[model samples]
Target chain A: MTASPPQTGGPWRATGTVAALVVGGLGLALLGLLLGRADVSVLGAPLVLGLVWAALTRPTEPGEVVVEGAHQDPDSARVRASVRLEPPAGSELALLRVGSPSHRTVDVAVAAPRSRTVGVSVSGVRTGRQRFFSVVHRETSVGQVVGTAAIRAGPVTLTVLPRTRPLGHLPLPPRLQGLTGSHDSRRVGDGGDLHDIAPFTPGDRLRRIDWRVTLRESGRGARPGSLTDLHVRRSLATADAVVTLVLDSRDDIGRDISTWSGYAELHPEEATSLDIAREAAASIAKAYLEAGDRVGVVDLGHHHRPLRPAGGRRHLLRVMHTLATATPSGRARPVVRPPQVPSGALLIVFSTFLDDQASGLAATWCRHGHRVLAVDVLPPLDRGRATTGERNVYRVVDIARADRLWELERAGVETVAWHELAGDERTLAIGLAARARQRSRPR
Target chain B: MSVADRARRASASARVALFAERLVATARIWSPSKSRPLPRVVADIGPWVPVWLVTAVTAGVAVASAAIVTRGTVPWAIVLATIAITVAQPDGPGAGIFAVTIGVLLVASGTEPFAWPLYVLLATVHLVVVLSALTSGLPRRARFELALLVAPGRRFLAVQAVAQPLALLGAVVTGAGVTLPWLPVAAGLGLVVLAWRLDVRVGDDGDG
Candidate 1:
């Protein structure tokens, strides 16, 4: 953070109001002197005295203002910019202008001889990489008649992340790897799922012995009705699943069809398609990570940015930070297919099926034996701003998108609409995970 | 240059080109539109409504008082109305003109010094000027904290305190039939010296 230079903004220039008062006062008193009307000079006394006081109290030293930034409250979009004002002696009010989207400006009368932090609120800001604390501030001298030069402090670069919804059950990989995790693995070990029933071995614990089975086997053995051999129950080992979230940042189109073209940029305040994709990817990653599964993130448009699969609460934050860096790229290096993930990792592709490129890549992943789940991140259609020709073009593109989605289904890829997931009901997600678990069951 | 140098140069150019593309893509982050509904980010102009209303009413009061104090005729009233229009604007020069006009009328009307009307006009002029300065040069929907008025109020009181006494002294000197030609010059010189004191650094490494 940088501080505004010491007001060294040159001497405080007198405002027009000060000149008005001086001119008015001097004119009256001089005229009274010429006419010997002492009453008139008396009448100008207040104005003259007022000007003298104002001149005496004007700011002398150049005071610097350091804008100490405060982050926006997570629950709201109002960014409270806390500015610390170190005003010169006898300075009056401070004017701060927060220039960006809203161009909100505020005036606060700060009493001198002490520093003060004023919080100016900025609302309706869009998510993504944006600037903050770009405050142009100056303190007023007597009566705000004169003040220091305006100084701009900073345009601090901050990446505001997209909002993520808390998702319910998310699908997992076919073969979980970690021995100590949430899902049941087919490896023979002690766990919740039954693996086998057999005579107890030397290494098996007494807790594994099944009393009814032991008695039945003993009766059938040489020692009738007596415990001849110990029987035990064996269960499958618990393992963790790996899930990699692939985000398609090719285009961040908004609901308005007209703005989809490269000529017009989407409104920064509204949630664009990339925002939806990031939010959906974050939600899915969080859900899988919460289940003690290893989760990763990859940008399809920028293959250079990738996070290897890892399981932890910290890793979830890393996933979110990576997602926030996904700029709405219109032109990126072209690729034949999406980046590869770990073997048997669940690949969830978050994309706007505006074209066949994303669907084709997802199908390729599915054909490569990775369970690919496609999430549609297109905003709902509201053709209020579109012309008749644009609307017709949208309808044609919409149909082609639907066909591509159908093609994905045929290619064994499940497409989930991110926005259509109503409330807390996640039956589709639960079913998908349950079906994967069923497939991983032992014969 | 060798073949290796050409390859390296090509890679650097490619990187630069990609950077330019990304920059161009995000050139227009946001733009205001009538069709797109405004985002719900506090953009509240709620604080300025009362300030503007108060300023308008005060300007009206100043105009009415200026006319009444001067004992204005029809032509004077019309001139005062024009001044009122000037006062309606931000940082208007109307306060100076109105004050001077009232002073001219006081001299013409043979009004007694230290009269109640004189006091009334003085305070009214101050009020109008200060209030106009308070809302000067700000854009529509600009906000101002109420605490900002504290300094202006203090300055107003301090000025009035000194000015009222001088007003009485001038009246006494003239009433007693005394002549002091240097009084006006001395006040003028003091005004100059005081004005020169602006932005004078007096042992301040500002701990403000």
Candidate 2:
């Protein structure tokens, strides 16, 4: 996309080197004449020649700078800027400077055109729109004469999606739906795994009858059951899982409490809790969606930018794009009411849990019979150098926060600290293994 | 030694170590690390003060010194001052004028014929003016690129490689009262023009 309108060419201006040569030459010539020093006069020849050469070759036309690849992925976008000179004959060197308010400025120099591209790698430090404001191009001649032009391409805006980390198997909701899926349903239906055996009833499929069990029962005793009472194997049905991710975007606190005083002015390099929450939510959504489970997103603070439950690669992209656009709404209150999630769908709520609002929402969802997983996204606190009074205050706040989490656990809402779950492959593996063992054990 | 005396010595050494640590910290704050790149150095310096103002002041001092040594006429001083001001401006086309004026002032002073000290000082002043002019008002990000671009050019300007010996040889010949012919000067000028024309032609071909 065009960043800004291209600037028209301007007149060439003499650089310092050109000025030095001219001034030095003229001064020496005058001194030689007054002092009758032929050797002194002879020294000015090179300077005079340089001046004449500069005059002969001064650029008559200004150079044009065209920037391409201005739009970049914040995570891995490399911006390339190119300047194409109109009559590239007189120019010796060209320098281009690119800058944005949020990022460090970069300058690239290319020897006279045959236009070459200067590439700059940028880190995706923050989410939302990033704009590059100034781009200046300066060209110099062999005589050191400088010609400069400023090109204001339309500001290139790159929307940086929040980065995601690899997540292990996520907890499945207690209930499942639909006939076709990966997870086994407890009820008997047509499936791969046998559930139990019982006497065949009316409308039972002939193929389902267990011939071995029927023959064994017939030879059991004098009171053996008749053929009408044949046993049939029952299989558990497998159904798909639906997951709803709730993002608490009210507060974004970093590790340093003092830095939080100017929360809005914090640099993008310093990620806050909201950043972690977005990342966690994105990771969880990706893991489930990759597993063929339908995943949806709910922004607790922003009513807009919600994605409906769906499953596919395209749906994952939509969910990630929505997650990247998430910003803290700066609301002091919790969500007025728990968001509506589909029945039997697992609800994953990402929050810092600094206040009771997020925990209350998770508990509410749990009360409504939906399985809720509350993720504490707060960064670890560093209290190493704090004063006694400050430490006491922090202690009190930590205690209160811990009590809220305990209450969530008491209400049957499973709470997981993001730091504890982050990159912990064994936790999910062990949990899944235990769940499998439980399912296989005889009742 | 007594126990008290030993304890006092230990305390004194500890205080010295503490002072040394503080001194090093202060030094680090004032002096940038050598390994830092040009752009970082420019950013640390922060903000621009017009280069011309600084160049003007330095050039004025150089001119005043030349006047004192030459006992020159007021008109001569005026001419020198004007050249100095022009050279000081990074954008002005007065570098040749400034160099010529310095040479004339040196000759008029009639000090030792090949005064190496005077040449060295004048060269230093010229170097300062050129550097100030090139770097002033340049954006911080551009400073690193400018540094890279100017390296070869600066090497070309290091007059010691060719100009210093030529100037000394000419001074010695002139001191011996031998009148030089114009043929060599004419030939040199001809070669310069030929090189310039050749460069222009090559540039034109490249453009095509």
Candidate 3:
């Protein structure tokens, strides 16, 4: 830290050392006169000459300090900011300080009398909105005789959407809706899967009749004569599944519970429960949408309008965006009522399950005849620094959460730990998805 | 603008405000909340170490030079006190303390005008004067571009070139029983005018 920045922008001024030298030189001259010593008075001669030189050589204008071109690759963790520095003519060097992702600071210095744009990179960033490049800069003269005011420019920010990951085929609602889709339903109609072969009656399509089966049945002689009782192949109807993702964003706690009281700060790099929840929700929504299923989202915290169910790539983007913006409400209001879901839509809830409220909502959604899958999005606890009392508190909370998860399982709402992995080295969500596909398959 | 345009602008402004708030929401409590005063030194990174080194070296050189010139307890006390003062408040008027003390001590010692030690003492004095002038009023953490020293260096050499020989000439002329107090004053004025006339602009020619 070289100089304290002034609150307001001001013109250049001489440094304190210049004033000190001037006063010291003058005092020596006086002392020399008092003592009648020529050498003593002349001892400070170089100082006076140096001051005169510095005075005449000071920079005339405040140079430019501009910062622009902030870039962050979606697939990469680094954020780069480009800064343009033009220290005025007499300036020896210019210094720039910039704030990076997760609120870390970086500094860079460049020799002045030149205009240059320098790029600084910051790494280890996660998905979210952040102030990428806030810069403070100034130019100082040689000997720092005089310098311009320290100026602040730009705290440029950008929002990086939550990333989507691939998942196995997910579970569907008990009943599928819509006429045109990739998935087959229980309702009998024209589809890819043959439902059964039965004796044809009036209104049966003639093309669906199987002559080979009719002849075989006639040989058995149960009820079929030659072409007397035609057999027609029937297939299931094509319909799309509708899934609603319920995100409990009321409390964004981390593995370290010490910061729950808001006194100790939780750094940005530390992944919070909400961050995990968003990634999980986005992955599920993408999977469902890609499978020709309509997916929607509900923020249990903000009882605001939940996203309506829809299909296609555009709706998938909309779901991801909504998931990205889901943030912790940071307050407690009793969940007077759970956010509403589409009738017969599958509910895959993402939550920490810290309290019974979120689990209770999943149970309630299950009771409504929707196939509910409650995802426990809590991160692993860091018990290394926990005190005896803190561990006890955490133990009590864990017991209650574990019971809530157990109750969810008993309620026939599938439960999976989002942070856990299965034998295949995939997230437990993939296991949940595989189980869902098995249950939806024709028995 | 149309009413729809005005609405759109308002919505955009609100969105920007919300985005800024979200960016600082969790961050403000950590590094972004309380103002972390940027030590306005223009280095690429933290310059506290380098600045501390320069200040320490300069202060040591200044004290040593003051001791050599004065060789008196009172001068030594005053010069030593400036070091303490620079630490407590670098922007204070402590830098000239040493130079003034040395000059007074030299006169009391009655040293020869052409003494070699005095010339050596003068060299240290120029260094202190230039460095102290650059660093005294600045923050202790101030980082300087090394090239910034070149101008002061050149100025030091230029002043010494004229002042040293002129001092010898004064001693010679005084031995001949002739006194001229106005000679140093005239020479200083001449140098200043000459420097201004030359008016070298470094930024225009080579890459800054």
Residue-wise lDDT of candidate 3 within B1-208, one digit each (tens)? 9999999999999888777765654464454324323221122321133455667777888777766666667766766786666544555456677677667666556666645545556667667766665554344544443444445555676887766665666567657222444544454465556544333432222224
Docking class of 1: incorrect
Q: What ordering of candidates by DockQ runs from best to worst?
A: 3, 1, 2
Task: State which candidate has the highest TM-score.
Answer: 1
lDDT of 2 by residue, A1-443 (tens): 33444554567776667656656666666776777765565565455555566578667677665544555444452333233334355665555566655455655444453344444444434554456535666777655556655544435555555666676666888898777777788877888798999999988899999999898888785776655358899899887799999988777676655344442234445567877787778778877888888999988878664678989999988888777777765654545666777898998888887788888888988999998888788877655433344467777888999899889878987777677553444244344345446546999
lDDT of 3: 0.68
Q: Please, what are the lDDT tens digits per residue for candidate 1 over residues B163-205? A: 6556556656657422443544454455445433422322121
Which one is best on lDDT? 3
Candidate 1 docking DockQ:
0.19
Docking class of 3: incorrect
Two-chain complex of model 3, DockQ on C-alpha atoms against the true structure:
0.20
Minimal lDDT window, size 10, model 3 chain A:
A1-10
Q: Which pairs of residues collide in model 1?
A: A7-A62, A60-B199, A123-B41, A124-B41
